[model samples]
Target: MTPFQTLTGTAAPLLEKGKLMSNVDTDMIIPKQFLKTTTRTGLSKGLFHELKTRADGSENPDFVLNKPAYAKAGILIAGENFGCGSSREHAPWALLDQGITCVIAPSFADIFHNNCYKNGILPVRLPMDVCEQLAALAGGANHVFTVDLATQTLTTPDGVTHAFDVDPGRKSNLMAGLDEIGASLKVAGEISEFEHKRRLMTPWLEPAI
Candidate 1:
């Protein structure tokens, strides 16, 4: 996972018929068909598969992501309860593959919120009104937005800054680019020492190879 400190890029608003769609679940972000792969590579092709694809398997030009201007958006402005439903890590994987690193919404599923941090994605929670304002700004000609994890602030295209809160540990891990595995490796020396002592103290607990 890449370290996240400050990100400056265009924001894509995930809207349906000019209105923000609520309860944007994981299946909507990346359908179950795309969850076959354990690795994160090539998942971008399946990101928002349903929304971006038409009934005849053609591209849905009306979708926000399919729009040329938002094709490479690095941030997403979404509605409440985003990333709901199943707890699939692939959701963030697909988003990251699609070059999206930050998602702003009024709220998010607990599991999905934690998964975002583990994958180096910043999921910001703000008031619904604030998110709507941000989405409107993102749809404008000047759609660039800046998110500073170190400062816990999001700067809109119009120069207004909004503050948000995040867990200290998660914030630290993101800033250091430390995923769960990476974080555990940081204490490898201590783990090895403890294992060595455990073997001597209770050899019977060891499994037979």
Candidate 2:
């Protein structure tokens, strides 16, 4: 997994709230062979087109990602209730697996948000107005920007800064690059020491070791 400190791009505004995954889940988003890519750059070429069409070659321009703005989006600043659809890990996996390290929106589906954390993607929540402003910003002439989940700040390429919020615990984990399993492992040595002490204190409590 990649370590993330900041991101800068001139791409699409995030798909807001519940509309995102639902609006774009059309083609299942990926295929087995494309998933085998060894790098992120070429991965975008295989993004959503994998399951979108039949042999006839017609296209679904209605998909959010197909829109000109979202085609190469890096930081997604969207609206509330984002990522609310299917429980497919493939969705978030495909996103991160496609070089998206930062996703900022008003809200995110619980499972989706968790998936972001584990996969090293930063999922942020801002107010609706903020998302709208970001949408406008994203429409400009190749506007560049960055979102830092650790500092809870958004930085435009012009150097403007906007403060945001994140759960304190979540902030710590992201900064340290620790997922749930990684967090638990931090105390393994202590737990082992305690169990050894317990055995010495009460041999009777230990079965026939």
Candidate 3:
């Protein structure tokens, strides 16, 4: 799998931000069965369709994505505020389970956004209008995109590019596959140093049994 170190898809594909998120609900991103995976991926088979009622293989006309503007959405151009719900890391997992490597919305719930990063999904924020245009594009049969994390870029299949913002530390964690605890352990020395100093300031500072 190509780790999207950098590239953009859909809207600015190169720089998608403040995406208007015209459609697509969080429930459609991942279904219940996928909640079982400890690792990401392999959730693709159950994605979208998990929530889509097909009593048979027939599409659920009432689904958000069934609407022309959101069909074939590879980059998930979504609503003003997205990823809102109980903190289910599985939500992002489900998004990753599908082929969606990146998501662009106006804003993301804190825990949900962090979960996306942990699972190798790059959740982006874009201005609302940008997302609207992309949703419009999804109306066509060939709606798709590419997100490149390395260069912090978003590129459309047509080759347009856009720049995005990310915390350097967080970006490094994603590039290096360091989870929060993993990254903190790499700085054990610094933590140790601080503890030593605190001990000096108060000899009895250590916690009692």
RMSD of each candidate? 1.7, 4.7, 5.6
**Root mean square deviation (Cα) for candidate 1:** 1.7
Q: What lDDT does each candidate get? A: 0.95, 0.66, 0.63
Q: Give the runs in model 3 whose Cα sits over 4 Å from its true position.
A: 1-4, 7-28, 31-46, 49-51, 55-74, 138-144
How do all the candidates rank in terms of TM-score, highest first?
1, 2, 3
Query: Which candidate tops lDDT?
Result: 1
Which is the better candidate, 1 or 2, if ranked by TM-score?
1
**Per model, how many backbone clashes are there?**
0, 5, 31
Candidate 3 or 1, higher lDDT: 1
Give the Cα-based TM-score of candidate 3 against the true structure: 0.69
lDDT (Cα, tens digit) per residue for candidate 3, span 15-105? 2243343334445556566567777667665566643557887877655455554444456667665776567666776666544667877
**Model 1 ranges with Cα > 4 A deviation:** 197-209
